[model samples]
Structures are given as C-alpha cells and as structure tokens.
Target: MSSVPIADHALLSDCRTAALVTLDGSVDWLCLPRFDAPSQFARLLDDEAGHWSIRPVERARASRRYLDDTMVLETSFRLSGAVVTLTDALATGGEDLGHGIGANSPHLLVRRLECSGGEAEVEIVFEPRPEYGLVRPVLSAVDGGIEVLGGADRMVLTSPVPMRVEEGTASVRLRLVPGRVLLFALHHSAAGRPPARVWPQGELAHRLERTAAAWRSWSELHQAYEGPWQDAVRQSGRVLQALTFQPSGAIVAAPTTSLPEGVGGERNWDYRFTWVRDASLTMDALWIAACPDEAAEFFSFLATAAGPPGEDLRLQIMFGVDGERDLTERVLPHLSGWRASSPVRVGNGAWDQHQIDVYGELLTAAHRLADYLTEIDEGTRGFLVACADAAAFHWREPDQGIWEVRGEPRHFLHSKVMCWAALDRAIDLADLLRARGRVPEWTRERDEIHREVLERGWNPEVGAFTQHYGSADLDAAALTMPITGFLPADDPRMLSTIDAVERRLTDGHGLVYRYLAPDGLPGREGAFLTCTFWLAHALALAGRTGRARAVFERALAQLNDVGLLAEEIIPSTGEHLGNFPQAFSHIGLVNAAWAISQAELPAGG
Candidate 1:
C-alpha cells in the first residue's frame, strides 16, 4: 500500500493527460495519451507499482506552490546547508510552436532542478511499470539517458547526465553547485516509436518557458471571475480546466480511478469518465468562472454524443473521453489497493444506471449557454424537446437519484425537482428559439412536478422535505431547491428544510453529509466537499450572507496546501478522501463563491 497521503500530491497537466507529483519529488501517478489510459506510474496505488524520484540525498524540508496563474509547480527544498528548487510541468503546445495553448503535444513530463545555495548531492531513480504494474519494462541505456520498452508502449528518458540501468531500473547521483541546473524529459509513445531527437538542455529550458507562458496566456484570456474569494475561485477554475479533455471538451469528474470513498470499503468507483450530470454542472461552473467558450464547446460535444434521444429518451449516464459508451467496470486484484482499500476498480458500473435527473442537468446547461449561442441548430432544438419530453414522461416513475445510489429506486425529491427544472428550462428554450414542441404539455408537467414534490416529497412531521417520498431522511441534494430555481431560497418551506438539514445532517464542523441512509454500500465515508459547498450556496441564496460566508470559508479551509480539493474530506481530521483534485468540488467552490458575491451586491445594482 502507498504511504503518501492523498493530499501530499500536486497535479501537472498538458490538457491531454495528467501527472501527480508528490512534494518529495516523486512522480507517483500518471496516465499517458489520455486521462483514462493505463498508468505509466501507479505507485500512488501500490508502492512497487512504479515511481520516479529525484530528491536531495540528504534530508530536507520542502515547500511548494504553483507558478503565478499557471499550473507549473515549483518545490523548494531546504537542507542543512543547501537549497534546491525543482520545477515540474507537463509540456504544453505554445503559440511559438504554431499551435494554441490547449493543443495536444507529444506526451512529455519535464522536471528541472536548480541549486541556488551551497553544493548538494541528489539521487534519481526511475522505474517504469507498464499496464498498471502488470508488465515490468526493460530499461536500456541510450545515448543521452534510457529507454523503457514493455508490451506495446515505449518511453524515452532524456537527461543531461548519464543514467545507469540496473535490474530494469535507472539510477543516478550527482553533486550540484550553486546556479547549476539539471533537466530531465520523459517522452512516451504507444507504438514503440523512438523519440525524434534528444532534447538538449537549452531546448528543454525554452520549452519550459513557453509552457509557462501558454498557461498564463490562457488564464488571462479565460478566467474572468471577480468575486470575494477571487484567488480560490481562480484556482478552482484552473483545476476545472486541468480536468477537461481538451480534444473532446469533456470534463472528467476526476482524473483517477478506484480512489476509495471510504478507506477499507467497497464504495470505490472509477471517475475518469464524463457523466452527463457532472459535465452539465461543470458547464454552468465554467460559465460563472468566465469560460463561456468551454461551456459552449461542452454543450456541443454533449449534443453530438447524445445524438437523438432514444425511445425511452434516456441518455447514457456517462461515456469515455472519446465518446465511447462501453464503460464496463472490472477489478484489479493483482495489485494491492491504496491503503488496503481493496477491489481497485477500472471503468464504472454506474454508466448503465438509470439516472432520471440527467435531463434536467443537460437542459439547464444548454439554457445557461443560450445567451452566448449565436443560433440554435435543428439538432439541438430537437434534442432539447426530447429531453423535456423524457422528464415529463419519467418524472412520475422512480429511479436512481442524483447520487447514483446502488439500491432500489425511490421517488427522490431532488430528482423530481430537477425534472421540474428540465421542463422549466425546456419551456424557456422553446420560446426563445421559437421551435415547435409540446410547450403546453411541458408547462403542465413542470407545474405538476412542482406540486407533487411539495405535496408528497415533504414530510409534515419532520417539517422538511425528505430524501424520497414517504421517508423522513434529510439529503444534502435538497439544498439545490433554490439553486435550480425550483423554489425561492427564502420560501417558508425551503427555510424549514434548510434548518432541518443543518440540524440533522451537518457534523458541527461545517461539513455536511450527502445522506445517512444506506445505499447498498458497506463502511462509512467522509463528508462530501461538494455537498458542504452547496449548503453554503443555499445559505447565501436564502439571504444569510454572513453565515454563508462563514460556511464557505470553512469549506475553503479544507483544501490542501496547493489549493486543490478532493471529492470528500474527513471532517474530524481534515484528511482528503476519494479522488484527488475533484472537479465537482472545485465547481461547487466556484458556484458557491459566485452565489455569495451576487447576494452581497446592493439591491437593484
């Protein structure tokens, strides 16, 4: 099992793939070519899976931060008498290369180390494990560095210094003087194609400069969020962009798989695939973060991928980055799980689950982007009608809720409210586009859902809305009532629900649980970070500005040192759980901050 805390790792991305670099100068987890590709380094799951480390020989303390407005990470190591800084980034295609900042490039991971103080000794180790540690690659010494060959994959490591290959591993040690620099670049290819040429030290430095500049340029052009939590919102925006699959405009829930929701539990699931619900909300978050282009692109991708709604009008719950629909789940028992969280999984089984709330999310996303859209195509107009029709027909039936619970279906209040939202947005869209559709039917169904939820989904004895019809359970998802405009935040019923949720669901540390009801899963999980943020957003919308800011700050305080958040947080210990740098958590942060900012504005301003 890996010993490193999940929070100890920082992310590096080229918008095509991602690498997780630990503060101790180890690249522990990485996937080549695509976010869901098999790992090239899997030590984050198992210690012997694979890892590459470059750190000072002597013990040292380290501090790290991202470069100004960029994903480039720099870690400073302070030893007894020496200081060294290691810079890490996944190389980007800059304008200088005649491509845009988000263009895909040859898969390359770059690390530059420079000594600024007294002389220091550093050691380097490289162990390439192909197919998630299923194949141990053969390492051969090449002209500049080393070549790793295994299965159908080939990786070339080019370094300024010679590396010795021993027992399939590469090791090197060097003594560095002040102002001296050392650089290493690892290029990957799936077809065993050799690197075009070894990058010289100067060329590597130039690429680093250009990559940093590209990131800065993109931030300047895209990030327009000016809110009270400016820094947090901008950082969240960057994390969201990093999680995006640039080629397809599909935003992954998280870049990792099988990171257990609860340690030593079977609640683990792969999240690398794009969910209709997550992608739709991600589009809304991007719009609020001043990324209108991304929102539009995402909607376009969804429209094309979804094609025409089927007879049932049920869209695929999720899909691969390339829009493939077969996301079958399987377990890897060969490798020990992270921290003994067993049954490490790949793909996701929930892709086939019937999630009724997706229509609402998709339509709401399209409605949000309508202002930026120049014209509505026939395909999109038909898609909108189909979605609204699906909601109208299915809202009365029971299915999995938004949490994708693995148990029997029930009349989840959130799903019903979102069904109302689906028709609500679709009615608005139909009028805006002047498209032919059952607008009257949609309006009737929308009102019917609203009335049904108010009458049946609420528990009179509990004095609040329940998780499902006839159940008194409180759910964090009900907080979306105001967010989706299904009800006024200050409505007497909504206020009672909010107060009841705070009284029953919160952990007294500002962290909120999704729901305490069992969902065919074993073991307990941490408080969901996104749900906590939703509480803050709901509070702000209800005009409790001061309390909302406090809750928002408490949620912000749970982020890791590098301003990254995970799917959940251990409320008692504040240890991050589940997938790292979760896009949903960041989306919640951005949207919550925007809500507070809007609420704080003067009346009529």
Candidate 2:
C-alpha cells in the first residue's frame, strides 16, 4: 500500500480536474479530464497503481508551499550542498474570463525544475496506469516527449532530454548546475477524441506563467476577507474556488475519493460528487471568504441537473460533477486501498438517500443570494416553492439523518431544525419569488415544526437537545441550530446544549466528534474538523469570543504546511485521518472566522 501520509499531499487544480502531489514531487492521485473520471494515476490507493514521481536521487528534505495567491505549487528539495525548486500547476485557460476561472483549460499539468544553488541530481519516473492500473498503456518515444496510448485516455508527456522508455515506464536521471532549468508537462485527451500532441518547451513554460497569472487575477477580483486568521481564511477560499467545477458551477465535497476516515478501517467513501446538503453552507462560506461570483450560476446548474422537484417530495441528495444523477457505488477489488482500507469505491450510494435537510439548504442559499440572483423564471421559482413545500410536509417524518446512517431511519432533530429554516427563508423571499400567496401555508407548518422541536426535541434530564426526538445522544450537528438562527445562541436551551457538547462530545484537545452513538458502521471515525469549526462558530454567535478563538485555533493548528485541511483529524495522534483538503472543513473555517470577526466589531462602531 502507499505509505505517504495523507497530509503530505498538496492540491493542484485547473478547475476542471484535480491532482494531488506529495512533497517529494509525486503525482499519486489524478483523474484525467474531470474530477470524477477514471484515474490516470492511482498510486494514492495502491502500490502497483500508476504514479509519476520526480524526486532527488539522493536523500533530501522537501519544503513546499502554494505560490502566493495561486494554485501553483513550489517545492524546494535541499541536500548538503545542493538545492532545487520544483514548480507544478495544471494549466488554466490562461485568463479569468467574465464567467469563471480555468475556463477552456488545456488539460495540461506543467512541471518546472530550477537548480538554484550548487549542483544536484534527480530521477524521474514516468508511469501511466490508465483505468486505475487495470490497463498498461503502449509507450513509445515520440519527437519531443513520450506517447502514452491506450485505455480510456490518450496523453503525451513532454520531455526536454533523452530518456529510456520500456515496459510502459520511462526512466531518466539528470545532473544540473546552478541557473539550469528544465520544463516538462503532460497533455491529456479523451480516447478517440483529438490526437494528443507534445508541447514545445517554450510554450509549456509560457502556459505555466499564464496559469499563475490567471489564478492571481481571480484572487484579486474575488477574495476580500480581512479578519482574524486572515491567511487561513483566504487559503480556505482559494481551496473552495479550486474545488469548484467552473464550467457547471457545481462544487465537489472534496477532490479525492476512497481516502479513509481511519487507516486500516472501512469508513472510506467516494466524495468527488456534489451534494445538495452542501449547497447553502458552501454558498455562505463563499460569501465570507471568497466572493460568491457563481452563486446564480451554481443554483442554475442544480435546478437543471435535478430536473423537477419529485412529485413524492424527495430529491436526490447528490449528483455527479457533470450533472449525472446516477451515482451507483461499486468497488475495485483489484486495487488495494490507501493504507489497506479495503474496497475502494468510485460512486457514492448516498445519492438516493432521503436527506430532509437539502430543501432547507437550497432555499436558505437562494434567500442569501437575492442580490446576486438573476430574474427567477416560472419553472425555477416553482421548483424552489416545491422544495419549501416538501420540507414543510416532511419535517415530521422519520428519515435518514445528515450522517446518512445505513440502519433504520430516525427522526433526527437536525433535520427537523433545517426544515424549519427552509420555511423561514422561503417566507422571507416570497416577494422576490413572487409567491406571496403561499406564505400562509408555509407559516402553518413552519410554526408547527418550531413547537414540535421545542417540545419533543429537548430532554430536560439530558440537559441538552438530543440527536433524535427522544434519544439522549448529543450530536455535533446541534451546533447548527444556533448558527442557523433556529434559536438564539445564548438562549437557555441553546447554551445548555453547547455546554453539554463541549463537556461530552469533545476530545481532550477540544476537537468535536459527530456523536458517540453507534452509527451502523463497524469501526469508529475521527473528530470531524467541520464540527470543531461549528463549535467555534456557535460560540462566536453566543458572544463567547475567547473560547471561540481557542476552539478555532485548535482546528487551525491541524492545517498541514500548505494550509489545507482534511475531513477529520485523529485526535490523540494529531494526524489527518479523512479525505484531504475537504471542502466542508474549509467552508466551516471561513464561516466561523467571519462570525468571530462580526462578533469582534465594536458595539455601534
């Protein structure tokens, strides 16, 4: 199995697809053409799967960072008397057009090596394992680069120097002195599409420069958050932007799939698809950290992709990046999972799960985007109205909770609270949606939801709001009630819930767990990074600024050297345990920081 620590990987995106690179300069996880495509390099999952690595022949310590405000990655490898800097990026369209970043990408990954001090020797291994290493491509030395032809993808690897190509692997070693520079790139094309060609060295260098410029321009135009943890907030914004599928405006929950929640465990999942549950929360984060430039466009994609609201009043919980609705789960048994976490999965089965909170998520998002929205057409307005109506009807039903438990469904309190929020937001936007006539119907169910939650959802003996209506389990998701305005943060019940969570649901370091209750899953998972941020956000809303900052810092300190966060953290060991560079974790960081900033503002100043 691959031994590289998950935190050792850094992200590079062209806004269409994503690649994960280790500090040692290996592209271990990449799916060509799109985020959800079959992997061209899959070493992140298995040792025998494909990987392209460029590292020093001798031992060297590597230090890396994202270049300035861009997704370009620069790694410096240092030995006793030599040092070299490697710069990597997936080439964008070279400009930020009026629509989105990375539009019209060239489908290229560019790498540049510069010997800055003394002399150094490096080894490059070019391996293409198409279809997740299930097929070995035919490799031949072409004019300027090696041709990799076979399987579902065809690609060309630009080579500036001669190399030995054999058995589908290319090997070469080069010695360089100070001031010497080498440029290399991989250009990708779908099978039976255009015949892919190698890039000239000069043009490859130019495209890299252009891609960096485009990212910087997008940052300048969009990000304007000035607050506590400014650097972390801005970096999270850039991560969110990179996670977006620019062409369709849908954002994946994370870039990589099958990264385990606990090593040697079975909690692995595929997260490369967009989730309706993330809609409103992701939008809220974009507004706080990065400007929501694609708010209207994102909503449009959701509306079109989801088709009509279901007549049965339930919608799909997730969709593929291309708006494909069928996310059937299957396992690749041939490939051993990362750290031996078995049965790597490609699609998410949760796509069809009944998640009642999605309605609230989308409606709340629409209400928040009122200023940025375009003219709401009849169909779009009706779809949203149906979402509100469905939520009002379904709040009382027992369904899968936000955690998507595999066992029998329960009346999750968080779901009920979100249903309440959906009606509240829909009523607020009645005039904008031109549906003032539906207000009374929405109000009726909305109030009933409010009263029911207050009555059955809270248990006096538990001293906190329970996970389900009658259970004593306290969940980290309860933190959202205050954050979503379902209740005032300082209200007695809300304060009691917060206190119980802090005292019971947290590890020694103050990291929050989703819940202590048995989740149908076999083993336990790590403390959710997003839940920790939720605690901080709730504390901020409650005017507990000191503890808020402390909890925020507790999560912030988990960022790897590159300032990217994972889905969860192993509390005692302090290692990242779940999917790397998770969008929800970053979204939580942005919104929590914004809340703290707002709380810190002088009382009338």
Best by lDDT: 2
> In model 2, what is the error at residue 88, expressed in angstroms?
0.5
**lDDT tens digits by residue: candidate 1, 573-593:** 998899888998998999999
Q: Residues 388-498, candidate 2, lDDT per residue (tens digit)?
A: 888987888888989998878899999999999999999999987787998999999999999999999999999999999889999999999998899999999999999
Cα deviation of 574 in candidate 1 (Å)?
0.4
TM-scores of all candidate predictions against the true structure: 0.97, 0.98
lDDT of each: 0.86, 0.88
Sliding window of 10 residues with minimal summed lDDT for model 1: 93-102
The per-prediction tally of clashing pairs is 0, 0
